[model samples]
Target: MTPEDRFPGPEHPDSGPRHQPDLDVLPYGTYYEPEPAGYAEAAYGSETYSGYGGARYLEQHWPATGQAHNVHDQQAAHPGYEPTLPDRPSPVHQGDDPPTIELGPPLAEPVPAYPYPAPGPDEPVGPLYVVGDVHGYLEELRAELRHQGLIDADGHWAAGRSRIWFLGDFTDRGPDGIGVIDLVMQLAAEAAAAGGYCRALMGNHELLFLGAARYGDEPVQSTAGTASFLAAWRLNGGQQHDLDRLEAHHISWLSRLPAIALEDGHLLLHSDTTAYLEYGESIPDVNDAVHDLLADEGVDEWWDCFRRFTKRFAFRGDAGPQAVHELLDAYGGSRVVHGHSPIPYLTGTVHADDGAPPHIPGPYIYADDLAVAMDGGVTMEGRLLVARLPI
Candidate 1:
């Protein structure tokens, strides 16, 4: 029979169209890449047979297809044509018939589900307060919440009928990152139960935290080229305690937090960056687009998205009002309230001491009053501000 009959398919007519080389033809003593010896079996096999010897025995018993058998030495065979490792011996069929073994007990019966009741329309909306970046200053956050009557002296939800929105950066560069997150989570639960709600926006620090948690020491491309998230986290003042306390719930929540929020003709966002214009026209659409990207993208792509979002100082100079006007025109908002750029930085204040109270100059209203900066630089010993809207 011609080689075409044996291999089959389209091949160059010259030299009988070089046949695909079979892996079995490789030398038996070919370089044996050192695996963990029994790593495969431990990963793929059951508890009963998962070690080195068991894996070796399994490979010997169920020889891979096109594997070269050494007539003299059985262990020195070349696994040429085999693309996969050997299978384990099954109890059912030991001889000619391929043995089949059940993997596990049948899945438990499906639990009955309760139908979700639809929410009523326009269910008594409350005044929304969008907070700026906290950066781990728990005491400042507490003071601000108290100032806004959102929380009481005992650090409990004080405003029984209002909503509070945190625009992210709850951790890093200051004390009590964990404490801040814990407080927010507790308040969110309490507020939801009490007919009020607490929501948050996603900031770049959150993306950094997520990357560090997932990639660990793996190198990822940043503005500084190939830098590991772990290194970046350390450089950005990520606490070891905070890293250890991070859970899937935190990551998922951070990832799902909206990039933009709209309230009473006001556009609420974390960063003062114009990169948001690349997403969509409407606030909801931009949020959805960002969420979709964070959900579907890999580490590199997500990091790039975060890097772009982290670009602040957009509403700082002469071009500031122009940028605010662009957002206002697109999203139908009269003003933009953002956080990433701290108020103290806008006012050019330097912190004297760790415990010294922050000096926030009357809310640092800028961009011709089109953009409001609320960060107050609490992380830098500045005041935690809570301003009434339409000022």
Candidate 2:
């Protein structure tokens, strides 16, 4: 299908004002409130998809040394570069006044619930939860996780034996990307000790950050003239503070994140694009291919991977359900859960620069109820979404 054919116009029913519902009492995904109309025409209109035509997808990939010694060698080769992490695990900055993010209000009315059955005595896993794109809004993230009973007032993992998967894009666009990463790393360790595990996926922004850190200003070929990883990252909301605080451990952690995961009958991915099919047919093969690429030193190949994953809206419009089916057929998930295209983008009500806040009810269920969008568009003054799965 043509690029324009993939998105719905304002006249389309999916682009109309959503039926806002009360969130606290409802089990998510029991019903669906379609995102606003005109989102396609408003968001992707006039954008070319051939080679990074839009600002959202305007990022190139990276080339890595593949070994610790090589990274150390690169640091030595480039003087005055010290990669050291902060000793503390808090997302709040030390000494400075805490960054204040005025989060948007949640849904208005009540919806039906779909509670999962309690695990049997032999059941090994606990409750499952998924987090959308954080985009460096550290405080908002903490508040949302706390609201979901995942983390406690102290910000430590309190959901014992419960699994939480962050759908990537942890850094950029807002304040304290590094702080967010540090917090996630800390949670992963703490959760494992508590029997519950906290893990993350690799988003396009991760690739952009890694490219900037590894390649710096090294030029890469782009359809929009010559581009570099650092330049693209900055253009796509890369924060100077994040870059300054980036350490070797952060790099290693980000580098090793998987592109996709299958959890509790949900296929979790960072982006909504069907480009994952290009990597491999099954989950392990796809992840292995991406990991292998990141472990190599091919700049263009890495850029291609990043660019492909950056593609969004593949599972939207009329063909959206079918697109989701393709992934499910190969990956063994009843639903595809992702975070890249923000919920507002699907709603078409709020832009990133809009002064007013956008009302995001909860995880958007679409694609004929076969896919769920977790991003609450935190970067656009929208809510940071943390949801329990099967919703």
Candidate 3:
């Protein structure tokens, strides 16, 4: 697709608004919100595939990756780049407040009086929750997580031993992305202390934000001819404030994040793609490879990681099931849970039947139940999904 095609507008004719796009930074990215008439197959991309369940085939190239280095090595190489994370991390400079983000409603599902069956004398307690994309919508995240009883009244981790995994995109687009990252970093420490853990999976946005901060406007060879990391990031809603506040610790944290994870027999990833296999045969190797790439200063290597990762919908069409099976077969997981491409994009509804932007009642299960999508379209006025795992 052409740049205009990827981000189409009415004046552009080729694209129409399909869903109220969930963008981290508001307004720059979305162009298609489907009218009552819906859309033709080719309009979405070079694809053809249907929705979940019995497929007429609504083709979904699909979801799209990062690089080299230890922090000490990076600091030595860059000169004058000292990033010692403060005990309390805060990067938003005073007087540089970002624009207010209008976060949407919280994602809620009917809960039983008790979340799980009461444990027998021998039963050990278990509660696993996965949060979808939080593109700098910190308050929304805090409110939504609190509702799930994960955090306490003071916004501290309170879920004792339950696991909470955040599927990346913690910064950029919306205001206070750094704040969100700070909270997660803090919670990870807190959660670990409580015998539970709050871990994160890396998302493409994390890659984009890092790239823009490091490379910014430097031309890189891409599948779509010459493009700069900065242009692509800003076009996709990279906020100036986030970029300004972007720090060494944030960069290091993002670089170290694993692209793939496993929990409760489910394969957790930030995007629904088979790209992880290219990094390594195993999860540890993949994370290591990405870390190495981030630490390195090569522009092309960074761009390659960024470009390869921008791909999405790999597991969505006639070949989607096989694609999923391949990832599972290689990764050793029965299911794939991911965030990146929002569900509204696949279903093509910005608004519900009631004229409200449709909220995902739950993670979208597709690819013959091999995958679950957690991005609830929070950036688009949809619910910010925080659902328990194995659903």
Candidate 4:
């Protein structure tokens, strides 16, 4: 079967062959080496799962825009394949009836309105704010940032000295992932020009995205059934438009993001897993280890790294507080702030039987008040959170 037959375009049934762009002219396309012999047969031989059948959120046929979406020449090699934006379902309306939730006993101590003592006149750093997972909800992100007075109406940094740290998962599962990254990159520059700074952590999706871009359809060993980086990405809400629009700069910026950070006594990370321990014991050591691993071209190592980051829910059971302490003891933080497992899932509130979206008011402080869950599950009709620390 042809590459086109395996990964068809929006108009697969009626589309005719189109012009292929010159690979040498596209910098991003260099990452797309041709698939190995019989790769299409080995990877996606069955007609049932050849295309978008196994994936969620991705439409069978997305309407095409006139612009060229296949910046990756590897996609261009497939004569009929053309990238398009995902047409995800709309979020549930706010007024809809919410599902029944079993309430647990209230926490022994409520989250303090003011956890930290007010800074005196001589304080050096500005107020610190951390953003939750932004899985391609660019507009929602903009609105929330504006609401927080971080950015102005024009989307420029308006907060003069207040720092912002984005807990990652910047791409995938929604529309305009590239646009979101572009905004963040732009904001980082803008924020630096001012007194403050904007930064991000490396999420699991970041690993998946990098793996898919660098390795493409190459086979990877998996505990699950047959898998490759590309297939796994698709199954886990990878957007065609994001991949198609990925540029060299975006790749560089994402690859260099730190896997973990410490800010204002908060241990900031992307996922809720302790897999980070495997990389390094110290903060710099961990980030350095992650960056070094990605710098190499070994596909199996990349896949393994991606898998390790994907583990979650470590801070969610009777041993949850102990789990939080494990990270704190190594990382030197009073509390852990994260954004991978959403609040709904952590609270057992994922299913909204009454047709309403899962309600996530703000950051969830749990794991014996040692960990903070910032992911509001934007991909699942929940909020995209941006919060101040010590909440």
Candidate 5:
């Protein structure tokens, strides 16, 4: 099928408001410009897809796959200049307050009971639960949540009055990413309704999926001036089924998701990179910066923002503490809880026995109490993690 035939159009009942394009459909990257300010405002102002009843939205906005100009092309176009480093702003003089961001209005009023499942009368309330990266694998995700008593036998949420934070990467690389996202969206709504809340951070995959859906075959001249979303998606494991489910509304919701959130005293982010410091001084500012980038559809700078945000493994060894320190100093959190880097890699298990695949069963505490690597490599033969937080 042709690209047009493959993508079709929005499938969700709630497509929300639509807009006319200034230019006609062009091959990806034909009209490269900075995204307009109105783009962000329009994209984020819609109803969120999170909540138990919003599975349709999840299915409609799933990730897509394809090949475009390759990253090698990006490098070839750039020659010697590095494209990964972020553009830096002029250094501010000392004594200036590192930028401050006003956290948005309280998400919603807390409910009386937990939305998913109330804890047993005799069971102690779990401190807080943080799940690792669930790259699809809905069955594994369900099993892990059930193992933690976060859900019941019926596959419904059951953790009442307890908070749960998903470290992101809910989709991609495995079957049923859409299902996993749908469940999380629903649990977030249910938890909020129940006085507790279920929250997630944005992973690079989320950004990739959002870009592929919004831009599709539309090419954006990368910093290298030749790369496009089509190329990026293929490198990143974009799936055809995900593209079939893409919708404008889902893109809007994913674009608005926060890049980082602090729970209790733990800092939660999708990747271990300290590049968040480049956006703003605090968590809120960083998130806003990310949202601002997602909203600007035309600007090549938006792609640059995404490219920088996608870098991972920044917190592996010597740089790990420094990276954690930057976030801790800015976000006022004691520990940085993150996904993106799988636990097996973080724990140095990449070269396990020949037949035994790397296994990261649940949330992993790392960095000598400074960081937590949550991606359990569920996309592999490992387990999906759902653990009590504040451990």
Candidate 6:
């Protein structure tokens, strides 16, 4: 299969062969040379995943209105490494649900929320804010938060009593991925202190990075062939700095992040895939199942979680609305608010020549408005999306 098959961006689920346009943009939906056991990844066969998959940190800012940037070439040189790691585990069937999970955080008890004055019964609830896939662009995130008045000039939580959720994929592709995670961690604590809450949903890149870190060089079964987590991570834009800076706190926080979230009537998620339906019928069941899988030490189990969640665009084409209904039926929500798939891809505005996006860069509500796409393509001449909810 061509890269188009691997990352069919915004096409019909039953799409037949069409003339492949811009092989350069082949899988614009979202690679790296694998290195030894350290920072970079090893290459699998020629099954090209989208270059936009991993971390993409650049010293320069993402082009404000330039054409969608393409990864011109793979930078890291392949280096030989010790391959004496454990033999591959048998590929487990990619299932709808991960191993069944008991509810709650991996920790013994949930962190107690500090009490604040309860709003009088009639007081209006605060605004709800949602951020799209940050992709490790920390300063861009800061600027957007500041613009939204979610943070103060000093980058502290200034939005009080409001709920802000980050549709995940905090690390990878951008500089200071760990910095973004650190900031989010700090914000969650501060937001709670200020009577607001800052939360996140796990994205595919999160699973990809975590797998690379925890089970580097350990081979897992892939539909294509034998694949290793470390190599795939590197190919997907794993930055050495982010991996190096990963701390126990980051892992603990990310692991605790729910795979599915329902906020203010929107079913918040990372990717636009129906694979979430595979986890469980309800929100809590899905979240707990995700945490349980991440907590388990099994590499194949983790691979299943990573591989499945990475699937995207389940809510597009003719069956899109029905897919949305299925999710809404199982999980209570009027809409599915998501990131992972960029808005540019949805509107076919990617890689425009003049750098001007096809549509105004904001949320692209489609699938009969049953779904909302928030990734304004900030990583690719797109704006950092800081959208208010109840649309």
In candidate 2, which residue ranges exceed 4 Å CA deviation? 1-123, 351-355
Q: Find the number of clashing residue pairs for candidate 5.
A: 21
- For residue 102, model 5's alpha carbon misses the true position, in angstroms, by 37
lDDT of 3 at 77: 19
Q: Write the per-residue lDDT of candidate 6 for residues 177-248, one digit (tens) a residue.
A: 999998998899887776678999998888988887788767687665666676666655567777777888
Error of 5 at 266 (Å): 0.3
TM-score to native of every candidate shown:
0.65, 0.70, 0.69, 0.71, 0.67, 0.71
Deviating ranges (above 4 Å) for candidate 3: 1-125, 351-355
**Could you give me the TM-score of model 1 versus the true structure?**
0.65
Query: How much lDDT does each candidate structure score?
Result: 0.57, 0.64, 0.61, 0.66, 0.55, 0.63
Tens-digit lDDT string for candidate 5 (156-189): 6566666887877766556667777778877877
Worst lDDT 10-window in candidate 3: 53-62
Ranking by lDDT: 4, 2, 6, 3, 1, 5
Compose the digit string of candidate 4's lDDT tens values, residues 1-391.
1111112112121101221222112111001111233432343332412222211123333222232334332332222333433222233233644332212112223222212233355646657888988888787788778656677768887766668999999987767889999999998987666656899999878888888888777767665444567666665667778888889999999999999999989999888778788889999999999999999758878877776676566776565677778889999989999988766556655555674566565677666678888887777666677776556
Q: What C-alpha lDDT, on a 0 to 100 scale, does residue 125 get in candidate 4?
A: 67
lDDT of 1: 0.57
Query: Could you tell me the TM-score of candidate 3?
Result: 0.69
Q: Give the per-residue lDDT of model 1 (tens digit) for 1-391.
A: 1110001112111111112222122111001111234432342333311221211222233222222222211121222212233121221122453222221111133211212122245566655666767767677677657645677667776555457788788886656677888888888876766566788888878877777677666656654456555555544555566766777777777778888888777788887777787788888888898888877877777666666666665665556677778788888789888777655344433332453333344345566668877676654444455554544
The candidate, 2 or 4, that scores higher on TM-score is 4
Off by over 4 Å in 4: 1-123
Model 5 lowest lDDT segment of ten = 1-10
